[model samples]
Target: MTNQIYPCLWFDGQAQAAAKFYCSIFKNSKITADNQMVVTFELNGKKFMGLNGGPHFKFNEAVSFVVDCDTQEEIDNYWSKLTADGGSEGTCGWLKDKFGVSWQIVPTVLPKLLSNPDKAQNVMQAYMKMKKFDIRELENA
Candidate 1:
């Protein structure tokens, strides 16, 4: 047996909306539970519960979901879906959804470049040139 902790996100009456949005963006994703005040969903096999715990708290960048994508198409797809509605884009593939949930939609190769001493600056340069990540650009950089 393994012990793992999942994130339970608190929302201001938008738990269901968040769950649906997330499920639509990810493959093999679905909502496991739905109620007036709570919704549970799985994204890329990681489970999360969204709680409609009223407007007492708001989501911030202190915690974020980092989506590692393999291709530019995947990155674009996620970025477009997640940044829809009132969401805003931030630097380095970071975005805040309509519900103020922070997300980082990055290419899977980013870690490889960042971890490589020789390619770190080139990768950073590529990242700086993009509002959304492009794997081809990073690879060429």
Candidate 2:
């Protein structure tokens, strides 16, 4: 294989299904390749490879994909779609989908707002109370 950096996700025989689901959620995404052993796909221009490695490996929150949003509507849209159907919510804008992959849906302005030492605490406090980030609240903080 060529030397290239890409996230290789392990799935228990659900690589293809996971790739399709992810493609449906993100724009400019598609499955580039698929077979019995592996599935390659792209999300927002980033490439990922999913391996049908079976149940020997399982997903955990130690690694997560962060989806940055520019507006509350965008945040809401991602939150709803990602947490739909058997997904569960976690604190600080974290969630796990049906496949057990963790995701962090956050506002693009979050880092900027939190970068200010004076307002960082307030912004963090506001985000702590929210499952889905609210841009207005962060700005007010």
Candidate 3:
């Protein structure tokens, strides 16, 4: 076994629910294990463990999962699923799920644009006005 530490999220008695919700959003995703206290799942090939710690602590924006999508459809799909059931939307394609876990549903081209010296400012301008990212607009800008 490798010594890498997979993210272990703390949920308020909703570990299973969170795991199921995450698995439903991504292709090739599934819950690998589950019990009364913990649920394990893979989201787009990444492993994560969720704990039903009974409302002791909550998720915050200090840490977040960034989904780099190749197309706008993928971004929209993830945004929709992750924001379901009392999740709140934030600026710049960021959102917090019902369990308060932060997510950035960003396009793959976003980093390219931001890294491009020629179009970086324009891309930033376009992104500044948006809630969910518009990949086409970012490309055009």
Candidate 4:
């Protein structure tokens, strides 16, 4: 037997809708299966399960999905889309989608920029005040 690990999200009677919404966002994603209670989907190849478990549980910032974007345009695209409708932005590339799911839209170059001892502070300072990450700003920092 093989062990497979994947995240299961809890939704308030919006499992299928959330799954479909996610599928529409990612380039290669689809809903594998959906029923009244559960929806299984793949986002860019990673499997996820969304459960229509009612309002008993809610998503919080404690757990979040991180999207690594290679360019500012990518970051901006994701930020704008994910923060649309009822979604809201948070500090440092964090945002809550319409379903209240937290996501972090980060630049792929962030790690390398933050790892540089000389500019680490500047990089940190620059990103700390940002809602969406800017690759150019990180590089300049």
Per-model TM-score on C-alpha atoms: 0.90, 0.94, 0.94, 0.97
Task: Give one digit per residue, the lDDT tens place, for model 2 in 73-100.
Answer: 8888888888888989998899999899
Off by over 4 Å in 4: none
Candidate ranking (TM-score, best to worst): 4, 3, 2, 1
Q: What value does the lDDT take at residue 6 in candidate 2?
A: 96
Question: Candidate 1: which pairs clash?
Answer: none
Counting clashing residue pairs in each candidate, in order, gives 0, 0, 0, 0
Pick the TM-score winner.
Answer: 4
lDDT of 1 by residue, 24-94 (tens): 88888999989998898999778899999998998889999998888888889889988999999998999
What does candidate 3's lDDT look like per residue over 73-133, in tens digits? 9988888888999999999999998889999989988888999999999999999999899
Model 1 vs. true fold: TM: 0.90
Q: How far is candidate 3 from the true structure (C-alpha RMSD, Å)?
A: 1.1
